[model samples]
Target chain A: MGESILSGTVFAAGISVGPAILPGIFPLAPLLAFNPFTEPVGVIHYMIVGAVMFTAGVVCMALKRNALGVLMGIELVLNGANINFIAFSSPYLRGDGAPTLGLDGQLIALFVILLAAAEAAVALAITLNFYNNHATVDIDRADDLKG
Target chain B: MTGTIRMDSIFTSVLLHLPAPTAPVVAAVDWHSVLFLLFAGLACGFAIAVVAAENVVRMALYLVFSLAATAGLFFLAGADFLGAMQLMIYVGGTLVLLVFGVMLTAQAPLVSIKPSASDRALAGIAGAALLAVLLAAAVSVDAWRKPGVGEIPSPTATPLGMALVGVRVDDPPAGAPLTGRSGYMLPFEIVSVHLLVVLVGAAYLARAKRRKTPRAIDVLASSDPPSQGAVLAAAVPAVRTTSGAGGKSALLGGGH
Candidate 1:
């Protein structure tokens, strides 16, 4: 049994060593410690990621001429906020005495996801109607309502 | 006593002589962090890709990847039930949106709508500033910087289920009054009703409409034949001016 365990250990080590060495081959070795692989991640890391996605979504909404593209942006923005809620509520991501949100965060995220789906449905229907009327899906031409 | 001491020393020596265990090396990988990195990278990358891509179909596809990655993030954060819900609803929503995009853009002219270069530059600058502010705020929270508990929380599906029905089965908020906290029953009911209304409204809005032009067959079927001819002559000019590429009369060529 001991012999089998030792052999398995050696085999696993051999496999892991190859990948670990390959990452070293990259020029970013000096920044290896800062990599998420080397350290335990926390809520802040998740928050930063959420921020990036939210910003991307905002930019998408602002720049995309296609109505569907704008809808996609809105989805991204909602997901970003959902990430933050989950991260904040996550017990695993909370340190001792951190006053975590417990189930509330997840609850809010759940509602957000549901509402987002509903919003998307209504928005898509509107976009289709707009396309039917105007013969285009570009938001730029949606100025029929403009005063 | 001497014999036991000698046995202990021998056991220690045996452990020391054997190859150091590989447990540390294995544990060092931090699979949680690795998965977090993988999911977060994909989510953010695909979101940006969705924004950058001009083709609506490609943007929808990228949005799928981004939302799927987000679902993975939810799972990592220990919201397994929410994660699954996100996957099911969000992906279904995306699929519906994709169908709409395909249907509307089947007329090849509408496939890609490129925004002006000035618009792109302005949006980029605004996005950057917003990102800077958000990142600064996210990092500035001192309590949030503390390392997490790093333990799998007990599954929360049951408590969440109860909570939705107006029961606060989970732990109450810290330092709150002894009076029991309220649940989400009100909002739940409201959303359910709202969704129903949205469904009906959307169906009404998207239903196929009769073409504006009076078809020749329809005119022949009408009792007032001479007056129909006069009506067609009067309508033709208006239809010609309004219907641009796919003129209304031509669209009715194949009876719906």
Candidate 2:
């Protein structure tokens, strides 16, 4: 458990630097301007960042054999989508008047969060049942479902 | 100290870029952004840590931090109700179930499950590629690069709450009002029911095994004995029981 907490702190520190580091990789990053901050915060930039995070989550989901790992991946994907939704709703990145999903985007993100919780509960229960029967959490052993 | 400019006004005035006379009511402070960054950073970081950690309980701990951060982000984003729901439901309720499951499944020998190095390598490669592609797509969209339509709009909690109840409180500037803006009453109701079913299902799954505990004679006469985690405490000399922080045996379902 200590290892997990350590990793969480490390990963958060990494992600915290994302907004600061991203501009270096994308030269055109400065051209757009939606941010209300003294700096240039653009919708494209936010969306792009969200997409990266989402993509990372998908890969994590696909590769993890542990049920918990898979759940973590789902979280990453949800967070990525959330970043996009918020970026869309933010006035700092978009111009004075543009089409937006508006409150609907935020609402959708909220629903996604709530449902994610429900999904976690159901998944955790199923995982426990699997362990009870098989004495392990290896998803590979669940191949009986293929039959 | 006398020259101290209020932090909120300094930010609002500079960010708004409007002359004092012409500027709309610029809040001395927008507490939202300050709080938003704090939570967003916490949630995203802890989530990543959960992926790297090997210990089940530690992973659960990280999950708790991540969810808490996400809840804070929700509030900062002006979804106060959603944020509160996130705290009460996901962090407090569902996560507790997850922890219980973790406790049940973590047998004496299998608490910290580490992934093989090869698997980690493959996942890292795939994750990197996916991140690259998504980042490229995000940068390609030109419209998203400009200031949004709702930029600097008034705080939205009331309108959002009313909208959830079936109202379109804010009119779009210089455009025909939106159509089919039905509030989220239906989805809200559905979520409540979904939660109820999940609660019942989790309870049933976690119920104590109905099969009777092995009879006392079963250990020496018929059944393998239960591990002495509880009984061993009183049986062993007190001086020998503790192995301190580095002791994995302490975590082997031992009450101590």
Candidate 3:
């Protein structure tokens, strides 16, 4: 009886470990289960991409001392948000009977793009003025107002 | 031993249960997902590149590619007008403005100001946290995870134009609770006025200022030890002198 119980426990462990080890050997195996290339793309995929871009933009904004780099970061952040908006608006990407933003999403994205352009223009003007006065675009050195 | 035999049998059973890698299935590939993957890869890759790049010009270039890929994504999502506007305004206009800014301020010392290690680490942590939260939120909704029906809606450019002129030309989506769709004419006018104000304000802020006395920067540069700022300040007078001559010629030309 003791031997049978030990054998059963060992069998169970083997069964559990086999699948885990197989994935390690064939890394793409697990990824292929979802098979994005074969299946249709969804809003979730766009959201993931937007999330990555947004993160990168935030990091760029935080890490760059150059004023123009910060401005670029702002652009990336805006584009990321625009992607989410477009995805939400897309009728093709909606689930069965799912409510979509329809034209409103596209309109909002258009406004965002326009505003981003305007913001960039104003921001560039500000950066140029700062550079003209201080002869440096390093934002850290813009300490004249600091008490 | 009996234990070893049992383990071997279990492994065999597990392998049998696992589906064998059959011949490549000639299934119909979804071109939409392929294009989406391509554009998403380009957009995300270049966005990360923009963050990782050290040179200002390279960052701007990466930004252009990233924004262009995002435009492609907008097109894929059926926002054709938005995509065109993105290409024209974002990739064409704003990026050109950005590149000009980079060139104007591309002094040797300012081109690549690497953040301190501590700042980078802190920002990395914060960005990672934010991304985790966003991704969690994105995938948390079961409805959002459902595969799309992949039906291409009709072109919206005409309806969108009509809507801008205070008319809802297109029918609302099925099951939407809203009864009457409002026109966007008011917001459109507001944005137009806003753009005009921004244009005037930007022009005013960026206009050249002719200072009678030495500017604070020049004063500081002259007082401080010899550095890039002092060198730049020394060059500024030469530029001003040349510009003065050019301005006189322009006035002469205008008189003709």
Most lDDT-accurate candidate: 3
iRMSD in angstroms, per model: 7.0, 10.7, 10.4
Candidates 2 and 3 compared by lDDT, better number: 3
Which 10 consecutive positions of candidate 2 chain A have the poorest summed lDDT?
Answer: A31-40
Best by TM-score: 3
Q: Considering chain A alone, what is the TM-score of candidate 1?
A: 0.74
lDDT of each: 0.74, 0.60, 0.79
Model 3, C-alpha of A39: deviation from truth (Å): 0.8
Per-prediction TM-score, please?
A: 0.73, 0.65, 0.75
Candidate 1 lDDT, B1-256, residue by residue in tens: 2344565566666756653343633445567888998999999999999989977888888888888999899898889999889888888665566556666665676778899999999999999999989987876676676666686677888999998999888765443344536699998989999999989988877766445876665544322112212333333223222333233323432222
CA deviation > 4 Å runs, candidate 2: A1-28, A31-37, A44-49, A145-147, B1-41, B147-150, B172-177, B208-256
True contacts kept of each: 0.66, 0.33, 0.72
Ranking by lDDT: 3, 1, 2
CAPRI class assigned to model 3: acceptable
The candidate, 1 or 3, that scores higher on lDDT is: 3
What are the runs in model 3 whose C-alpha is more than 4 Å off?
A1-33, B1-27, B210-256
Predicted complexes: DockQ each: 0.31, 0.20, 0.34
Docking class of 1: acceptable
